[model samples]
Target chain A: MTYCLGIINQLGIVMASDSRTNAGVDYISSYRKMFDLSLPGERSIIICNSGSLSVSQGVLTLLNRDIQNKEEQNLHTLENMYDMARYIGNKSREIQDRDRPWLEKDGIDYSCNFLLGGQIKGEVPQLYLIYPQGNFIQATPETPFLQIGETKYGKPILDRTITYNTPLEDVAKCALLSLDSTMKSNISVGPPINLVMYQADSFEINRKLELRIGAPYIAKIRKLWEESVRHAFESMPEIEWEQETNDSEEDIFID
Target chain B: MTYCLGIINQLGIVMASDSRTNAGVDYISSYRKMFDLSLPGERSIIICNSGSLSVSQGVLTLLNRDIQNKEEQNLHTLENMYDMARYIGNKSREIQDRDRPWLEKDGIDYSCNFLLGGQIKGEVPQLYLIYPQGNFIQATPETPFLQIGETKYGKPILDRTITYNTPLEDVAKCALLSLDSTMKSNISVGPPINLVMYQADSFEINRKLELRIGAPYIAKIRKLWEESVRHAFESMPEIEWEQETNDSEEDIFID
Candidate 1:
């Protein structure tokens, strides 16, 4: 019911998410799924969530509560990006476990997943996908992106465009286009897109935007991408049907 | 796993499928998924299949046996394209039912789906997607394509390009490209690709091609499409990130 992704390139990390959440067709509503947790000059943490809204809310509440109370093992106390991811994963599992029995009685699923990406004061920038089971995997140079929810429709573009050495601005643009493609194919993932870009080692979140359906920039990106894709398709070489011959039945039949 | 599709256009129907089947990573093999049945000039029926290989083989075996014996309710006895689809669906269901319990005992699935398309004498050209439960749905002018098995990766292009008004050759080209895209993203779907085209009212099967991984025409299309896509992506207008502003906290926070 959501589409969120995080990309790690040489310049830094780019995270994006759609804001639509629905309990059912009639209960559709907009709920922001990206959370920004930055400690001014010390650290910057961005978390993009997908799955049950209740469990996501519970995890976020506990995280913010820990931050406010300055808990011993809060986000602020985490030593590195991996530790931060582990903390988030553990909290997510805790919340899901708390509600699983009651929600299961009503046939509701309480599992949620998160994309945790940011930089700690002493560590290089990193990106991780935290699963509902409290396990996580970090992005590698060979595969520099992680996506959660409604991922297939938006995957081809990312698979073709992104790399570990891609520029920061270009990665951000690709992320937006990926979300735009998903929104077109699936109704469950709607607009009011949230995007954040963290320049490697900056420890500050200055480049962020929220785009709604009618926003001028959003309109420009959608129109340009559509036109470009159409142009690409139009220019493809025509199939040379005349030059090929059909094979005998023996060549094609397995049995 | 397989990727097969049928597109109905003004000129006629275009059907395509990949040739890979795998029970697991180590057991990958090639099995032709497209079968042709033509009474030449009287009827031209093409069937593309996906799912349990054993079930598909069983259904095909029964259909062939009925044809050999000139049974009263064989494929040649079908009155129209819809009737043909129903016949195929019924045979598929019969085969699945026969093996369902035994397969379940081994924790295996005995289900298969089919895309049946072609023309019968005195009937309009048609395409149908037949379910494992022995029910089928025909493609309409508004939504003129049906796909089965590993469909998502190839769907965006079909959504963007194909229509009832598209020319027969173009539709065939689009089907190949769709299969190409699926093969690129999913290892489960691979070459050699099988394509068949039927011109409306012809009541005969004349155009079909089998393309392998290194076939000259396949290589040409892949090169041209990749180049065109890269060019299109490069020409897209760059995003103006500096002009956008982050919204207030209330705009982004769910709580």
Candidate 2:
């Protein structure tokens, strides 16, 4: 299992992902799930992947090959973020189509998903959730985030805190906390977490981070967030049970 | 979909559940998921269920029939809480086994799960998670809670707040908040929540609640908890970015 999230507000986009992947409990390993497929100045494309490792890796290899071969519809050649998303989705479908039959024979999942978030030269920054079947949905102002895998455990915080007008840095902080919440709740979502913040129209990938296991920054935030949540819970109002005796007393008084 | 939780501490056990069940998004309905089967002064048996509505209802009907007929292995006649769990698990498996073939024809799920928490005479209070396959596991001090259906969203709070020594009222409060969180994150789990708090060795269920949709208490707590969580999230420490310029300056100093 994996958890990847992308949040786009007016200021910029924040993309985050966990690094842990496993074929089974015994065969756990870490791999970078976030890729900065940027052209520095022309177009900035960030892709975060989840699901079957083979399928996602296959899609990435195809994408990099397309770039190396200077294909007509590669990420670097795409004129807009929407086309870039379609290109990635198409590559994903191609890989899944090739592998689905054999993977089915062994009961292996051949599907994968990607979160495409970045800015092209002409378009404003955008975020998309690409499905396993090559379709996608864009994030809007009302719902300014897209998540790919193991999404629910980390969603409540995002639902409560993120908005279209949220600051870039605060969005980054929320994204990290969302990932941390997921990692704490699920063993399969352990980290090293990857995070990237893209400034709208910058067309450059400047602020990026990889917090490996036991990193002090990760520890500090995890500890503080846990404490804060505990404090919040302790502050929740008590349940006010209805008094059955009071109802009987009222009946007796009326009589 | 449903979300039922059971948390047992030294003082007592607190059980709570949401009331929403859906055949599809268009066919959603509300049904109570918590059951009080206590034989006051003899035993206190509370059952909360999740998964296929038909399977759960079938199991419940069978349990009631056995009790009504005074069957030799009925709930009231059971020797201990462990036996009660197995009895419920057996009933669940019986329903699934009988309906699995028909359900399979249409790919409808026939599996269900139950959280059975209570105490019988001469035994300490206990909690058991009965699986669809007639097997169950008990909750211990280290992990004092068991949850079923749409569980992950509500788990982090329980993991952080529940302990063997947590007060009964506090546990009940946490349980309600946990259900509220799940309902907020998922549309399939919603209000008309049911809760019960059973005191250890009392062999009675005195405190029970039904918070219907838009119930004032539910609304108040939901609002308060949302505020508390937002406050907690906002209080989280900021991420400290690594200074890339420092690395370059260090290199220049070495030269």
Candidate 3:
């Protein structure tokens, strides 16, 4: 399993992913879900992917091969993030088509999804959630983040905090906090993690790191998060218990 | 679809459930997911259920029938919470058996789950998560709360804050906040929610209510809950970038 998140904001794009996968309790292994592609000074792209590791790896291998050949249609040749998203989606579908029959017989899915985002020359930072079938949608002002893989556990934090106008640095903080909550709630998504933040128009990702075991900041965030929920709970009014089954249940509105 | 939650804390027990169910998007109706049986000063049982509303309502109807007929082997005869859990589980299995073949023919699972908590004589307040198969597990200090139906979206908050020492009042607030988050993220779970609380050693539910929809307290809590997440994100550290990729090659971390 993986947890990858991408936020497109006015300043830039922030992307983060965890590095853990397991075939079972005993088959745990590490894999970084964030991949970076850049044509420095002109275009920069980052993708955080989730789902079948083999499928995602195949897509990445193809992208890398295309770049190595200096293909006219590789990530570097794409004029903007949208084309890049379509390019990656096409590569993913190609792999799925090749694997579908065997994947079905073997009871496995060659499914992978990605969040692709960054700046490309004339364009400001943009974000996309690219599906396995090759279509993508960019994040809008109403929805600024795209999360893939084990997404539900970490979504509330993103929903409550993210906005198009949110500061880029704060977006990084939100990313880590979101990761912290997800890591606590789920065993499949673990550290070390990959984080990248592209400050708009800089064409260089300013925030990137691999958080491994003994990351001190993680412990502090966990502790503070517990305290915050406790504090929030202490402030709410306690449930009042005056109504009986026989009483008009509408006794609540009268209160 | 429904959302039901139960928390066992040092101060007491807090249980909440939503009432909406649907055969599809159009055939929506409200039915209470919570049913209480309290023999004041002697015994109390509160069940918040989700999944296969038919099965759960059937199980409840049968349980009530046994009590109505003075079947001495029913819940009132159980000496402790553990026995009560087993009783409910066995009854649920009985109900499922009656509904399964027809449901399977149509490829619909006759799955029903329950969060049962309260007290009987000579026991502290207890909480249990009863599976559709008539097996159940009590919530211990390691996992102080149990949620049923569309559970994933609401689990992180409980994972982060609930523990053996959490106070009962605080647990209620946490339960509501969790429900509020779930409601925002999922369409299947809704209000007006039913909340019930039991005090330890009292052998009776202290108070319960249908949360007044559009109530000032709930509106205030939801606002504060959102503010808390934003505040939490604000307090965490920003991401640190480590530029290791060259512009010429695609960055792939795993083979």
Candidate 4:
């Protein structure tokens, strides 16, 4: 299991992924799920994948191979973010189709998903969630975010905090906190989180971070967030027991 | 879909459920999912259920029928909480078995789950999550809560706040907040929410609430929690850009 999410705002895009991969409880390991296949100043292509390791790796390999071999149609040649998303989806579908029969024979799942987010020089920055079926949905200004894999535990924070107008740095912080929330609730999403912050129209990612578990900055943020959450919880107004409230109302009426 | 949870602490148990039930997105209605089957001064039994509405209703009907008919092994006759859990599980299995084939023929899911919590005289307060297959797991001192249906969105708070030592009223407040989080993230789970708080050895439940969506108390809590969460988020320490940190380190080393 993995948790990867991308937030797109007017300022730019923030993408984050947890690195833990497990075949089962006993065979746990870490693998970076985020890939910066950016062509630098020409285009910035950031991808985070979740699901079948073989399928995601196969798609990544095909993508990189295309770029390396200067294929006629490749990530670099895609005209816009939508084309790039379709290209990634096609690659994903190709991989899944090739592996589906063999995986099905052993009762294994071959499905995988990708969070594609970045910009081409002429087009606006965008984010997309590519489904396992090779279809994808773009993040609209109204939604402004896309998530794949273990999504729910981390979603409440994102749903509460993100908006299309939120600043890029704040979006990045929200992405990290969302990942932190997921890692706390689910063991399958442990850290050494990969994060990328791309400024709109910049065509270059200036802030890429690999926050390993127990890294000082992550540790500090985690501690601070925990203390803040506990403080907020403690300060919540106490419940007014309905029975007691009803009893008081009756007393008032009688008086 | 529905959202229901039960928390057992040293002082007592807190159980809550959202009331929305839908045949599909177009056909949504409200139905109470929490029931008090307690026989006061003898035992306190509270049940909250989620999943196939028909199956849950059937199980509830059966349990009530048995008690009304003065059956030998009704809820009132169960000697302890564990036996009561098994009884509910058995009843659930019976209902599912009776309805599974017919529901499966229509490609509908016949599965349902129950959160059984409270005291059966001569035993301590307890909580159990009864699975569709009629097997159940008890909440322990270490992990003091059980949840069913649309669970993950609300789980992080419970993971952070719940313990066997939490006060009964605080536990109830946490339960409401947990439900509030779920309701915010999922349309399938809505309110008015039914909540019950059982005091250990009291053999009666006096703090049951049905908090409607527009109820003043629920609205107050929701407003306060949203404000508090926003404040906490705003106060979170900003992320330190690793690029800047490394640059400063290099400058110091060069100097």
User: Which pairs, if any, clash in model 4?
Assistant: none
**What C-alpha lDDT, on a 0 to 100 scale, does residue A133 get in candidate 3?**
78
What are the runs in model 1 whose C-alpha is more than 4 Å off? Answer: A242-255, B240-255
lDDT of 4 at B70: 89
TM-score of 4: 0.93
- C-alpha RMSD (angstroms) for model 4: 5.3
Segments in model 3 whose C-alpha atoms lie over 4 Å from true places: A238-255, B237-255
> Per-residue error at B212 for model 4, in Å?
1.2
Highest TM-score scorer: 1
Instruction: Output the number of the DockQ-best candidate.
Output: 3
Per-residue CA lDDT of model 3 for B37-119, tens digit only, reads: 66667887887778887788888877777766779767777788798888889889898787799999999969899888888
lDDT tens digits, residue span A1-255, model 2:
899999998998999999899988999999878887777788878889999998888888888888878888888888887888888899998988888999999988888899998888778888998999999999999899999889988988887788898788889999998998899889999888988889998887778787989999988887887778777777777778755332222211110
* Residues A13-112, model 1: lDDT tens digits: 9999999998888889998899887775899888899998889888998888898788999988888788888889889988887899999999987878
TM-score of chain B of 1: 0.95
Please list the residue runs of candidate 2 whose C-alpha ends up more than 4 Å from where it truly belongs after superposition: A244-255, B245-255
Worst 10 residues of 3 chain A by lDDT: A246-255
Q: What lDDT score is found at residue B50 in candidate 4? A: 92
Q: Is candidate 3 or candidate 4 better by DockQ?
A: 3
Model 4: per-residue Cα lDDT over A1-255, one tens digit each: 899999998899999999999999999999888887777788888889999998998898898888778899998997888888898899998987888999999999889999998998878888999999999999999888889899999998888778888778778888888998899999999889988889988887778788887888777777877777666777778777665442312211110
